[model samples]
Target: MKILFLDQSGKPGGAELCLIDIAKPYRDRALVGLFADGPFKTLLQQNQISVEVLTTQSIQVKKSSSFLQGLKSLRQIIPLIIKVVKRAKGYDLIYANTQKALVIGAIASFFARRPLVYHLHDILSKEHFSQTNRRIAINLANYFASLVIANSQASQTAFVQAGGRANITTVVYNGFEPKIYQTCESDVRQLQQELGLIGKFVIGHFSRLAPWKGQHILIDALAKCPQQVTVILVGDALFGEQDYVQQLHRQVTALGLKNRVNFLGFRADVPQLMAACDLVAHTSTFAEPFGRVIVEAMLCGTPVVATKAGGAMELIEPGINGFLVQPGDFQELAQVITTCLHERHKTATMAHNARKIASQHFDVKIINQQISQLLSSKFN
Candidate 1:
């Protein structure tokens, strides 16, 4: 079946990564539309997925006051909507990969009489978006979209709380790009040398440095872990939260963790980084819709320690595939890290189990199959 997938991002974040699965079923028959083209376009092209860049315009919206910026983004995306609606006639379905994409593609679906599936990656809760934005999302979902595919239960619950139709929403976890991580003894030593993980145990927190993502909390936990343990923070600051990044540096210095913690900002080779790590960490104080890092870590045969809140609980089974600590409980977090570091054999076993579980559940094939079925049922 022919599909037109739309993602508004130019960067390869969790949303764009998840879009890879959304477009997997239609690599040969589908065309992915992007708002602003960048590395993500190259990634889709590399995978033999057809991609089109509609708008070269990019607006950097800081989280401080995004309402004004949101209006600007919507205004700039008008031409994109027109182009998509004109092109969407041939597609069997419109799979919108993000909130803005949903707003655009939902209209396109209406124009083309194709079923619209809004892939809800971001939670509609007040924590992530403003009250005005949340209301708009609810209204749009209620009026335009045929179905909603939430990446996490928390996201689905948030949508329902925002008055979205519950029966129309399906919770599909954001999958890992496991092919990048599945390897037998990759040369992770390069990461070890680059990040200085030779003699120390590394606890990795790999996500964009956003306020809700909680990189500072991971640093707070690192202060309690053994001195031999190091924290490797991966990813760059998003929406210009440079003040938070500066504060973190001060906190690390105050805690005498300057030497113990390393900021490897935005590495493209994440699988190698995960493989070199002793353990992966998910420390988002707020509910992380889904921790792609947790699954990527698991896919690389590495044990993970994540908070029990949100989608982490859904993916991780405490004491089985990985350990789950209470959200923001540094004592519990410290204890789990200590346990994993001390018991090499047990951690190794959990890592093995993690790989087995991730391969079964989070593979791209499973996602492609589900999307194909969803589109088939709707179109048939």
Candidate 2:
């Protein structure tokens, strides 16, 4: 079936990365319509996927935007909606990959007379979204969407709690190709040596530097860990969170962890970096819809310690596959890291278990088949 996948990001976030795997099967018959142009479009092109930047103007509405603010921003996107409606006519379904994309795609689906699929990637909680934004998203999806594919049970639950239609939603975890994370030993050794991480018990944090993403929390936990335990932060600030990046640096300085912490700032060699790390940490201050880094680290056969909330609880089995700590609790996070550091054999065993489980449940092939079945059911 022909699909028109719409995403609003110019950079590759978790949702954009997930979209790449989901749209791969439909590459020959699908188009990824991005709302802005940047590295994301280039990444899609590199993969030989059909992609087009549908708009250059940024969407002005924020999660904290008021009703009047939202209405004003709606005026700005009218041309974008018209453009999407025109382009969507050739596709069988309009698949929206992000919240802003859903708004435009929902309206375009109506004008184009195509079924709409909204992929719910974020938790619709007060912590993450304003009430005005939440209501707008839910009302639009309820009225226009044919199906809502949530990234995890946590995401689905958040939607239902926010008065979304439970019947129209289905939980679908993000998928990964395990092979992509299998780094050569020489490569891992080289990366570790280059980064001066040799012999250090490295904890890798792999999300964009945002306040809610809790990069500072990891830094706080790092300060509490043993001197041998160091951290490598692997992403840059996106969505105007440069202040948070500055704050993290100050926090590191205040804690006197200048030598123990390294800010890599958005490198393309994620799997290789993850492979080189002894353990990975996911320390979101708020609930994560799904922890993509957690799963990716698992695929790289690295032990993970994630904040105990949202989809992280679903991915980790405490004391079995991986460990989970209370959200924002630096003490608990540090203790978990210490345990993994001291118990080498046990941590290795858990890493092996995590890899096995991640391969079995979140393999790209299995997830693509599930999405294909869903699309087939819709068409049939």
Candidate 3:
């Protein structure tokens, strides 16, 4: 079946990365219509996937945008709506991958007479979005979307709590290719030597450097850990969160962790980097819709310690596959890190369990099949 997938990001976020896997099966018969042009479009091209940048103007709406602000941005997106409406007629479905995409795709689906699928990637909580934005999103999906594919049960629950139609929503975790994470031992050793991580216990944080991502929390936790436990932050600020990045740097310096922390901003070889680390951390201050880094680390046979909230609670089984710590609790986070560092045999066992579970549940091929089946069932 032909599909037209819509996304608003110019850079690759968790949702955009998830879209890559979901769209691959339909590559020959599908098109990904992006709202802006940047590295994301380039990455899609590298994957040989059909993609196009549908707009040059940025949508002037934020997660905290008021109703008037949202309405004002509507004028700018009219041409984009027309374009998508026209193009969507050739496809069987319009799949919206981001919140802004949902707004446009819902309208396009109405005009194009195609079914709309809204991929709910964020938790519509007051902590993450303003009440106005949450209402707009929930109301639109409830009225227009034929199906809502939530990234986790937590996301789906948040939608329902915010008055979304429960019947239309279903949980579908982000998928990964376990094979991609199977890094060679020689490569891991070489990277360790190259990064000057020869004998240190490396703790890796793999999300974009944002305040809500809690990179500072990790830094705080690092201050309480042993000097031998070092951290390597593996991503750059994607949005206008440069201030948070600067704040993190200041915090690192203030704590005298300048030598213990390595800021390896945005690298493409995430799996290899994750494999080189002794442990991976997910320290989001707010509820994560889904912790992609947590699963990515698991797939790499690496132990993980994530914040105990939102989708993270769904992914980990404490002391089994991985460990979960309370959000913002640096004391607990530090304790867990120490535990992983001290108990090498037990941590290795947990890492093995994490890899096995990740391979079974989150393999991209399995998830794509489920998504394909869902689309077919809905269309029929």
User: Highest lDDT, which number?
Assistant: 3
Over 310-369, each residue of candidate 1 has an lDDT whose tens digit, in order, gives: 778888887789998877787888888899889989999999999999989987778767
**Candidate 1 vs candidate 3: which has greater TM-score?**
3
TM-score per candidate, in order? 0.92, 0.98, 0.98
Model 2 clash pairs are none
**Backbone-clash count (model 1):** 0
> At residue 244, what lDDT does model 3 achieve?
87
Candidate 1 lDDT at 58 equals: 68
Tell me the tens digit of each residue's lDDT in model 3 across 122-230: 9999998988999989999999999999999999999999999999999989999889999999999999999999999999999888888999999999999988999
Cα lDDT for residue 60, candidate 2: 96
Q: Number of clashing residue pairs in every model? A: 0, 0, 0
